[model samples]
Target chain A: MMSMHTKNINTHLVEIKDYFKVAISVDCVIFGFNDDELKVLLIESDLKEFKGKWSLLGDIVRPDEELDEAAYRVLKERTGLDDVYMEQVQTFGAIHRHPAGRVITVAYYSLVNIEHVELKLHNNELHWHSVKDLHEMAFDHKQILDTCHERLKQQVLVQPIGFNLLPRKFSLRELQNLYEAILDMELDRRNFRKKFLSMDLLMDLNEEEEDVPHRPAKLYKFNFDKYDQRKKRYLGIGF
Target chain B: MMSMHTKNINTHLVEIKDYFKVAISVDCVIFGFNDDELKVLLIESDLKEFKGKWSLLGDIVRPDEELDEAAYRVLKERTGLDDVYMEQVQTFGAIHRHPAGRVITVAYYSLVNIEHVELKLHNNELHWHSVKDLHEMAFDHKQILDTCHERLKQQVLVQPIGFNLLPRKFSLRELQNLYEAILDMELDRRNFRKKFLSMDLLMDLNEEEEDVPHRPAKLYKFNFDKYDQRKKRYLGIGF
Candidate 1:
């Protein structure tokens, strides 16, 4: 549904950028789940303004760019990944949070299946740090990460977004672990099993994990079609 | 405390605006509660671009002006009301949500103590419309208002923000009614009483209603001090 209005927006922004010297920016908190832990992607800063400090993936917004495009550009430039599950979480404007002087950062968070996409850090040195194991970050990045983490936790309970952070074929145990990690609470195995199965959003693949130490658990894929059909009837409002 | 950073931001924006033709704007969904129903302030569009259609209380953003200041300015200009308790809920940027091209609107929702704030509309065509009774609005304001309504409901439960929408000293019944109106659900009075009192954020003022046809109810004022202390502990993270 690309409306004619969207074209007008592109042209308008081009004109606005030419006139205004305002430096809009985008910051992304890329989330990846692995082995019952929720991790966020961080980059080592190069700018002398934030030298030697780890920061959320961010950069100045291009003058003639859409907000979402700027966010995606930042992600691609830093992570070498595209078409990942991304959503705008919030915008931070504390006036002086940025040392570059009055730069407003629109924060976007993404849920990427770490197994499918290869992590190519390009020019920036990037690493995945466990949310629990985060140290002091550059600028107001600690606060930005906290906000994105909370949004991710809130979203997990209401939507099937967690699937985006896991492999296409995942075990039931893996799914349970993802929820427990994000919510920061232990779930009763039996109750969790009953609840998720009742939703009928998981399809049995009749396959088992390969190259495991012990007996491998059966694999399953998210039944996106079923979830879509039941979403209207689903009352997944809050925890 | 206004930081030196804010002062720098003010100055930087001034220099940038001299070059850019960008304008700042504020759109307010001034919510009011009366006759046990939730209402929002709206205005008839003056521009030939949106002739005769209803719109939100919005105007252009000023150069070097704080976002909150711009919101309050629009409220005072359109409704002749000042000192309103407004919160920046979210920013909407869908490329074409505005017909005037890519004008990204940062939405601010104000909870006017419908009793304390005067409905002195500066624009003769401005009026308060019940949220449920609203038809098609100019631009994507209907969508923006819906998002604000959700934010208002969520904030009302977790924080004692409802106090800003109601009279300073109000009865428990009135408070409960406000909750029911915003949440759009019938909460048990006993449960509601238990939940709110347990929070320990409201102080009994030991007063009664002035005009009523039924048994007068006792009045209470929100304990802002305790609420502030509780916020330090609670951090507004409620389900």
Candidate 2:
């Protein structure tokens, strides 16, 4: 049996309005990769407090929607794409973080192939800014972006999340480039290629680079779909 | 310049009342170790909706306090201890998850030594329930408990968080037993000893077991205070 150390709530009909309620929102850190740079999708804020500063795509959470659903809705409304890979990173709640009021937002980071986005169909105010170049941001967006970037950097080392930010068919050079961009470091090319080859996570596409200034490199596709199907058969035993 | 894809928010003073807002609270799963079983501190729910159900110790977060301060306040109120090790695992915001009207509570788990709790000073309603035998709980607390337990398990593998749950001086056998309890698996004695010894995380206190039925094992204390002090000197260089 459990016991408590606090007073009971007086749930009166009129007292409901007297209770302290807060407005919750969800922020999406949409990350993409292109031209050897990692980028995040951002929009201009209309709020007068942070004029001219870019803000992450976000909106107030409706009472009927789940937190994850609210995040997905924000993503779809901005990107016009479904079936995105998203992870909820953390929740930001500070009394004065929002100038409008005490609005706490759950932050989520998503990885998407840059080519999948059709810019013409999206709003003109939306733009993809290089993650390395962002300095000033509306609200605490820069902190949120940095938190998600650290998570992505750690995940890429142990998981295959980097594939989501790349083309279906890519060369070993391209994959290494993606890693370098995410980590912001120059990894030893020989050791990196050898490590990937030993893991056997890629399929030989039997294709070559279409055009290049130097000799064209061979291309291969991530061999995950088949492995993922096999893993789907594995069961997680609970305690 | 940043752009918007959705209509601007109409922040009318009267419209503010019409905006959807939810009450936010914090629930703490206080974990204590004693009698070779993992236990969680729970309180009896006086609410008629969940009669006889055990609930986690929690309270509605204040408007002025940060989310972390609310959790620490709960821990201090219940166990009469400060500076506890607590981590916020995730926030649960499913519709109707709380029987109360639209309350989304952030769940945090705290590790405490059982001896640290002076039950006399605390309310009589508080009791420690064995985590392994718990099946039903008030609200969605069972889900919250499992989530925090999963986080604790993962943290033990890479971090020294488990030291918070054990006594200051312990034998190697006692240390292994604590690890086994948290992980719920048997580790080879030889390998476990070798692994911990290689890390040099424990200080040889030059002590011996005093009261024991059989031969006594060497007693050692976690050498973390020194290591932690050294780590504090190191800085995190950001990109």
Candidate 3:
């Protein structure tokens, strides 16, 4: 019975069993855009201790799941959408971060186009909360949200990941609004348009906004292929 | 027998115990500068299966320790130094990454001034390997190393963390050499010096290199306070 493979298995069993007291979980700060405001999906906590408090949609990761898979699964199960862009932001492992003994959670922020996906809130508790209006949340989830939001703000300027929050065909005005909502700062309109156009990563689709009170702007789609190639060249150089 | 606190504890215990099969660890990619080359501290694997292969300096995170605390402990235990500039780069949690079990590791890279620390290797197996010369590493360490290296390269251009790898007072030439080594490309000396000086983050010590084969270059030190304030202003804006 003590073959090479068997020996390896035994060594793993003994070493792993002793360290199994620590549990791993994943928390997702899923950002969605609706009506020119940045929103995050949250659920009212079912735990009695956190009754009526909002919390990031999360679950204890199963033994068989990859960290990213667990996060994507949480997103899919909550929103009924797949193929959303998600990035792991950070791992939070304060010793008492969890009320349930020694649970460490990895935080991921995902961007989904709100108008594109039909959410299937399984418990009917999930709702999109405006990022600016968020109050205290359950179990250090507020800290997690802040961290992911900071990351999102940082990433939007450099990477084209912000496109995930917008519809496929979006006007320049809508793009500027998205940035303003995420950054919480007003950007010079002319400067913003000039900067983005100079990057050469947007395609003029010859389309205009469907409905608007004022003059509708020309529509453009992110040229992902060009962005991908340009991004590779910009790596290691900041901005 | 169960008060409110005890009842909460019991609930946590039951929920957490079911997910205890996952083990967590912290891996430190300790980057150090040696002889104008960017180097990483690695140790020879103790496992018989990986004999002679280099591994990141790491250990299983103890149940009582925070994730960051565990990374710092590994760095201190391995290098015999504290207060080094450390940052968590990313977490790797691929299933089967560890042959022993499903071990998820958070990777951190610490910049240590090699000349400042008296490294007590504990065993002769520990060595500083030039990053460019590293071959296959034990476990998934090569990928981990690459990821951390990429993060370090990206960070040096935007932040003052690279100062942690150099002496307190260094000539512009030394600083450029450090950048060239980390970036693996030759930078124009005059251009590099001009760019850094333009930031106004460096303070001229009015000192020269003490021992040099050629004429000693004028020395300067990074102005930490100015860099800290400047960094906040630069946030959300790409380099």
Candidate 4:
């Protein structure tokens, strides 16, 4: 008869073998801002079982690929863009979430300026959907999208990350509009300007918007250098 | 000759099989406060390669267990504690971090008050070490510990999670001490008390500390029910 310790070791080995069967994948919630509205890049599902539904851009992590690398690969492969700002938000791993097998997906959210990116839709199936009017998505992607969106909303309040969704030189009105769009609320214009200006993270570009029917507001650029210095001083707290 | 689509499908299948060899594990950074010092529970490394070095309690995640459940299981099996406050901080998956093959570990931090409960310590190898004076740890666990510690520090400012590290009823001085230990800095006593009182998340227990040494301060308990109500009203921003 085997000793209890030996039996325990045997059980551990068997458990390890059983766990090796589960696959890991990375899903990207590619967020973009345009027309003063928040949007997410989604792909038409190719799986026969869910042909009509949309899905966030994702791919299985390869044998040699890291989690972040897999997420970047999905972004680059699907959007034909690189060096985008991305962050891993959470991992979703509910049993029976995937139709194929036990696939655990690490979800990441990427923010990009829609005006800057010319998407190379090789398959003509990828499109940006307004976040406000999302349809049913394949798998648990709806929950994943909501989670990433909530993270984005929370992060925008404390961090200067929301500027990544705007053009290089954007007017204060545009900035306020972007914030209002993301946060889904109205802000007192004077208070908003005062708050951002006090942070000293925007550079007066001495430029103004063109080709607008209404008056073009003075444009300002995000001062990343100043932001980085302030970040070093503050460490954890952000304005 | 195989069509491009068929070739791509075959490559995907092969990649999935290759990735299946990688394993996943969960590591728990069980933080406890005692003797006016922040402590973390650690176990002596059983691996022959690192015999004496300490390691955070961890285990390979079973195929059937969720990531959070796996973390809770490690905390329960090692400390014999249940219903503890645990949260997944981050996933550490540096390719060669683990010596025993390709294992990706999800790191979690748990808070438990040392005086309120007894540690089972079934094995003599487990011990609680001061977080400030920890030496080299086994298998990149030192990095994991630092990450979780940083997260805890950031969270303590915005959330009332630090209360979990103290007794149910604690004095203003004890609460301040706990924050100083976790944040690694001395806070102004009057300011700290003012901030916590303004948040309105503590209830005056009308009690006092019972031990000898000094004039016992008034004790208070965390008002979690009030906190939940405030949380719903404020949504993302926690006081």
Candidate 5:
């Protein structure tokens, strides 16, 4: 009886060869933050079906590679940066999402500072489109982009991940601008400052912003040591 | 030039047919709360490699089906329940996580009232293991279980999702017990009740618990109307 069951299982595995072979791709929504606006990297689709339309930077997952490895590869190949913040947000496997045969793409959101961008576009092309003013994209990418952006908005509220988009030292105004860009809402300036201050996770660098038209605002650095001490209680953080 | 590029793209698509094919599976971590303990519905693994081991309720996703539809199908097939609250937590695609082939599984965490479980074991086996007392699971499911539990813990704090694990009417103690079970912490009785009342998302049933050994506690029902009215600001809710 056990052998019969084993044979049935083996037969089922063989059946997977014909019915379950799906092409898996990884599309990365690489979010970069400039001074006040949030941007996502895109490339013009070369496929005639999506000609002239922008699409996310993506590639087919290699047979031997892990899903995260595929996402990191896309990030490195496009941005030429290795130590960027990357997270797998969701998987998009709608039957008709891909124009080609059944391709299930895993969507990931990555954060990188716009200042350190070194595009390795070589032959292909890349552009950083501001997320607020995005045009229609190809192959359900606009939906993917929106989903990732929503995740980013929620993530920035609970975690200190937004720091990945900013430089080492930043003014309180710059931090508020980053939050506003991601949240897409105007926050009361004083309240935002008070809330962030109450977290007690910032260091008084005793510095000020340079190259600004108005009087420079005081600059402070995110205190990683304090945040590391209180890592698991990140849920208490909210706007 | 356009024809040459189109040919190159077609060649690449065919290459995907050969190499990028992978099997996709959806594993449901069905969490249930009964009285005090949090439990998860698990099934005995039929695969020989995982002989005598427990695994999540899951199946290979069909080619023509959407990912979410596949998850709903699994839940309906296993528990005989529909309209359950489910959320996709993450996708696990470690190259050799599956013994047979490169099968990348998406992990979804779902909440179901234990009273409603109608397991269709069908000559196989099923068990409801306490989340805290779970033994080693097959594949990377143990890690997946832990990750889902963490997400559930955070989710319960920031949303009114824990009510799904309970009956339509429950006591403050029962509610606190459910929270303690998911969060794995001993919440102060008064503070827990006070925090919940402050949310103003519960309706007093004007009744009390019956058939209990100790003093009966007042029962209340979750106010879905208020929650529906305030859906987007779920983040503001936290312990």
Candidate 6:
């Protein structure tokens, strides 16, 4: 499966290579979750300028590709995954941002159910590290990561995008903890429970946590259909 | 004065032009204010490909220049004005968004304080039609304008950017009219006034509307110092 996908991708690259000079590239901020911490995917820079340094998953713009397509292509090339929940965040363009010369990058953020993508073939050096422990990254990547992190925190409050980062069946306690990690604030458990329940967007999956010695809690799946309907009337006015 | 400013601007442009392709282009959402009605700026296209059509003012980026500086240069070149309040909004590049080849455009919106701009310089072709009355514009200008208009409406609620579109001294009623026009909703006059007063970002000028025959309203200017402080706090929210 991986070899066939790689061959298919190489074909697309050949087609793009023969077309017009592409001026746009997409950089992804793939956030993952584990051990009650928020983490992001990173790779060691293979370029001579930044060898041995960690960098965001990125690539050059293909001659005939749309910016978003390039972002998806780079993601697939590096991680061998598709259909992840992604959104365009911002474009960063300081004249001297790139050592290769003037390359403006469009940044995107994606949330993946980490367990689903853990088996994918990625760059040999690719790894996920806790956002809290991230250090200097190659080619302005640290700035890009910071910007994406800010957007993630803001979006989590107003959108149900956080679900994309978690398993389909999750305990309310686990969900609350995810929020605390992303927001970096200790939410009052009782108040947080009250607010989320009142929204009525969660479905009681009738499933409970397993393999734990302590008492397991009930699990829920986000009811996306109702969320969409409510979203139509949503004015983006809430936190 | 015009020659001196132009010379200074040229020097500044020259210093950065080597690092970038400085293409002067304009992305104007000509906003119209008619009887409390809001609108945008547009132009009739001259290209055979999109002849007889309206579109946003835009063109190729020149060699070596800052994106924001280029945006203003394009605005000034097309409108014969400087010192206008313009902002870099977004960069649009959906491969098929432009039919005239793969041109990546950085979008910008300018608030002209309509009364200050004569509008006689656009070869008598530029139009400021109502936002409600707008039809199909050339290229992807309609989409660009819609995006900028949305940003403008959001900013109005949180920032004092509306002042850039109003006269130097404006009445509270006129200010409310501008908001109602852009937001497409009627606001309770008393409540709107109360909100503005509480913000304390406006300075009463001890002057009144001069030309109206009926009872005149007092004038006020936006307080820049207070605005600067509020702006710093507003930027902290991670917009």
Highest TM-score: give the candidate number: 5
Model 5 residue pairs with clashes:
none
Evaluate residue B70 in candidate 5 and report its C-alpha lDDT on the 0 to 100 scale. 82
DockQ for every model, please.
0.11, 0.27, 0.31, 0.33, 0.40, 0.09
Clashing pairs in 2: A2-B43, A2-B44, A3-B43, A3-B44, A3-B125, A125-B3
Q: Give the 10-residue window scoring lowest on summed lDDT in candidate 5 chain A.
A: A3-12
True contacts kept of 4: 0.16
Show pairs that collide, candidate 4: none
lDDT of each: 0.70, 0.77, 0.80, 0.76, 0.80, 0.67
lDDT per residue (tens digit) for residues B60-156 in model 2: 7778989899888878876888788988878888888766677777889999999888653244267999888899988888998988887787667
Order the numbered candidates by lDDT, best leading.
5, 3, 2, 4, 1, 6
Residue B205 shift from truth in candidate 3, angstroms: 1.2
Tens digit of lDDT per residue, candidate 3, span A1-239?
22321122212234446775777888899999888899998887756667788888887777888899988877887677879899998999898877667878899999999987676644526789999998798888999999999888878976788999999999999999999999988998998888888877789999899778989889999998876565365333331
Report the C-alpha lDDT of model 4 over A143-177, residue by residue, as the tens digit: 99999998888788767889899988999999999
Give the lDDT of residue A26 in candidate 5.
87
- Scored by lDDT, model 2 comes in at 0.77
| Cα deviation of A132, candidate 2, in Å | 1.8
Per residue, candidate 1 scores C-alpha lDDT tens digits across B128-202 of: 788888878777788889999988876674456777778888899998888888888877889778877877777
Record all residue pairs in model 1 with backbone atoms less than 3 Å apart, i.e. clashing: A19-B20, A20-B20, B24-B60, B24-B61, B25-B61
Residue A173 CA displacement from its true place in model 6, Å = 3.5
Per-residue error at A111 for model 5, in Å? 0.6
Error of 6 at A55 (Å): 1.8
Estimate, for each residue in A20-109, the C-alpha lDDT of model 6 and write its tens digit. 322344678999887899989887765566778777776555546677787787667555677898887777666666655566777888
Can you give the TM-score per candidate against the true fold? 0.73, 0.87, 0.91, 0.90, 0.92, 0.77
Candidate 4, residue A42: the lDDT equals 81
